[model samples]
Target: MSGPVYFVSGIDTGIGKTFATGYLAKLWSEHGKKVITQKLIQTGNVDISEDIQQHREIMGMGWFPEDMTKLTMPEIFTYPASPHLATKIDAREIDFQKIADATLQLAEKYDVVLLEGAGGLMVPLTTELLTIDYIAQKKFPVILVSSGRLGSINHTLLSLEALKIRGLPLYALAYNLNDESQDAIISKDTSEYLKTYLAQNFPNAQWIDIPVVQHKDPLMD
Candidate 1:
């Protein structure tokens, strides 16, 4: 399926979803595939989209200018919190149907559209809809990004279970090198455990350990 859309969701928040999406998108673009990225909703930034900007900077995405609000970032809330709470605090209502329409339009234009969700799969887009609900509705394959930390195993397993219950396709599992403060031994063990477990169970899913990239282009740094 050309121009496929993958919803890059995390087992939990702050799992490097933005970096992972940008890194993967850059690789696909380098291979001559026209890839575009979008952040479903953004909070914590008042002026510009720091997450989308980082994706563009890292991927050298110059197709859309900063003025293109709906393309790069469909929704924005000044409060740095969940989409539902943030939208409420900002006194704004989110029209999920409109958001879905915009996303489909972008997908029609590119070989791939990597969507970065605000937080976890269960993250509330509104009081009624969740991030996972949208992915399930769209039937988009999911790329779950988990932080390789002490409790990552339980978190990843739970996340996988949630996706399974929703009948969402688990396309890939990405382990981000978490903070060094986490016991490296536990992190190593967790990765090995998930590798074997996922392979034996979900044989079709790809298990990847993403390197910690410090900058946009590692060569430039």
Candidate 2:
């Protein structure tokens, strides 16, 4: 049997989706589960995906064999932009079948696969296909990365509504502590409000807190 693949997406760009994914992979692996992470479509790089490198750094593990083989980063575009625009700029189209095949290959080996998306749910992988549309197509449970930053409530709710409209299962809401609002008041309230909202709405989903940590000096006191 294949392992479960959790689609990790954020409310907006730079919302710590990469960090949340790495944290979860490390956490689950520490608990004895074989975990691996894959980038759906990497942009802004060539020959390697910087996001995958960050994930490995955050997880404190060296590169995996899949990374060297390009299985973890199946599709890479050279431009630093959304997949649709990046693909256009690079004069290439995303090979969805290759990505699916890679994911299947990883699933066959790992106990869990954390597939990280390029951006928010609304981000277009192609002009006609949104990131969330791909998630729906794969029928993967989502792990939405959110933070207590300002406007999170609105953005998070909108994302939830889109998932609900498509009948997608939310596996967890990974709250990114590292990206919280600077104002303590707003940050605390945002967390409280979202927790209550999540409990009342998606009772089965887990609330995962991705803590802030200095990746560079992890061993420093």
> Global CA lDDT of candidate 1, please?
0.79
- The per-residue C-alpha lDDT of model 1 at residue 73 equals 80
Give the Å shift of residue 166 in candidate 2.
Answer: 0.3
**Against the unseen true structure, what C-alpha lDDT does each candidate score?**
0.79, 0.92
Instruction: Give candidate 1 regions above 4 Å deviation.
Output: 63-69, 178-182, 215-221
Clashing pairs in 1: 3-111
Which candidate wins on lDDT?
2
For residues 60-112, write the lDDT of model 1, one tens digit per residue: 76647422756668777899999999999989898677667778778888888
Largest TM-score belongs to which candidate?
Answer: 2
Cα TM-score of candidate 1: 0.90
Q: Each model's TM-score, in the order given?
A: 0.90, 0.96
Which parts of model 2 are misplaced by more than 4 Å? 215-221
* RMSD per model, one decimal: 3.2, 2.8
